[model samples]
Target: MNIDVGILANARNECRKLLTEQVGVLGVVISSVDGFDVASAVTRDLEPAKIAAMASSIAAIGIVVSQEASLGASKSITVNTEDGFVYITNIELAGQLCALNVIANSSAILAQIIYHSGEIKRRLEVS
Candidate 1:
């Protein structure tokens, strides 16, 4: 997807907003469906470029697995680890599909991540 300047600005704004509003969130990234980073906000020394590429691959895998199981489209993929959680979701921005990646510490509540990411997705869609 070709990144539009307006959309990239909006994405960066939203990422920063989410980081500020959430306590345990470590980073947020907006990526092209093809695995290119568009925008990101990080509180730690995280690699958004790597995360973007991985999110794209993970999303593609999720979709393939979902279809194989006849479970319909995969909504999102959540990875829970000892230190933190990684949430990978999708958003359609300016007619192009994009990936939304959220990295949070272990203290982050799952419900909040889901809720806030959903809000971010809605905003990106209409922006």
Candidate 2:
């Protein structure tokens, strides 16, 4: 059930396709909890590795906040901004936690994308 580099690589490609087709997303990245890029689809102007690292940092903060507030477990976290939004969710595969990020404008679409990504994670874990 442990996800290896090859699986992660495949997952990244799937994520990119899902983002582009399903969510009308511009940038998408699947990162490790420690802030390493597992997969990404981004423009040439962006740096995937750096984005992954930053997203991991942000996810860590969200986890801490959720823990401290007694919010219990958080399946996903979203941040909205003037330009777009950032969604980060925990991809629990075989007891291992990875992070998936989607950048988009529509909140509803982003939510659906996150949900779908979670499903993907579950499938990966189970299969």
Best by TM-score: 1
**Each prediction's whole-model lDDT (CA):** 0.90, 0.75
lDDT of 2 by residue, 1-127 (tens): 3567667666776776766677456677878889888778875666778889999999899888989999998678888877677878887544577788877765446567767777767766664
User: What does candidate 1 score on TM?
Assistant: 0.95
Per-residue lDDT of model 1, residues 61-114, tens digit only: 999999999999898999999998999988888888888999999888978989
Which regions of candidate 1 fall more than 4 Å away from where they truly are? none
Worst 10 residues of 2 by lDDT: 105-114
Q: List the residue pairs that clash in candidate 1.
A: none
True lDDT of residue 29, candidate 1: 92
